[model samples]
Target: MSHKKALEAFYHKLRNLRGNTRFVGGSLILFSGDFRQTLLVIPRSTPTDELNPYLNSSVLWRHLHKLTLKTNMRVQQQRDASAGNFAKQLMDIGNEWIQIDESSNVSPCHQTSVRSLKA
Candidate 1:
């Protein structure tokens, strides 16, 4: 099916489901790859300004913003977990290096040379 027809069918299905559920508080998450680029081709008969759904005032964008607000909480949680994991990895690697450094039997002269080379 054509892009336009597909979008229409999707919205129709969404509307039907929403109507059946009587769920007014939910958000719809739709993904189109680089929507700005795809929009140009998807709504072939419409003008660019009207077809571009990402604009802040557009109906689709408003729904997306609501959905994004809900997802932002989860995103923050994931980000925090990822940052903690990264910090733990760094600390573990640093401790390994410290152990290696302490066990190595390098003379003061060798240490100075290594430091100088690093600099």
Candidate 2:
């Protein structure tokens, strides 16, 4: 994921170019990404350092419309029971619906491709 500063810089540049500082040159600029997935890569940095540069951390975040998608394409398109179950588990993990212990570890309830995705 790109840093929030980079996006802000682009916004400023757009303002200078179009003379419209309203928001991204008064043009709609769509930023799409799954925050549950990977985030800013700050080498040898702590969790706080990594989060500080995220788009969500920026002042501009509050201005953008947030949309949440609920569909799981794997479960819908494949029409397989196992795939659906796996997808649900993955979603649960992402949404923090499944609780983790104080030890900061989660037990696998069933087989899933999350580990494979790490690879």
Candidate 3:
């Protein structure tokens, strides 16, 4: 199946089984593996750029109160790449938040935190 179709089907099934009482809460953590290296039960090859944001903004992310981990279960090479990309993406998002806050005249505590981040 094409990546888009597979994702659609996955979401459909998730929606169907969402309130089946087997699962605990509204959170659904979907982990996609490297196309070159299979990690989880789901298909091994999907475009990360296309799905990363969807995963981040999905019900799981929105509902979950905390994010304990975001680690790749693949081997060293894929793990390193995923980790680096994840870290950079997080930092960029944080910086964007700081920029937005600065434009709005952030509170003193937030300003201090931003300065510490810059350092």
Top TM-score prediction, candidate number: 2
Model 2 worst lDDT run, 10 consecutive residues: 110-119
Better of 1 and 2 by lDDT: 2
Task: Point out where model 3 deviates above 4 Å.
Answer: 20-25, 35-119
Question: Which structure is stronger by lDDT: 1 or 3?
Answer: 3
Which number leads on lDDT? Answer: 2
The regions of model 1 sitting more than 4 angstroms off are 1-8, 18-30, 38-58, 66-119
Q: For model 3, what is the alpha-carbon lDDT of residue 105?
A: 70
lDDT of 1 by residue, 1-119 (tens): 12444544565577687765322225345554423244444443567555544444344434443322213354456678777666566556645643455566766654433345664
TM-score of each: 0.26, 0.74, 0.23
lDDT of 1: 0.48
Instruction: Per model, state how many residue pairs clash.
Output: 0, 0, 0
RMSD of 2: 8.7
Candidate 2: Cα lDDT at 74: 57
* Residue 85 accuracy (lDDT) in model 2: 89
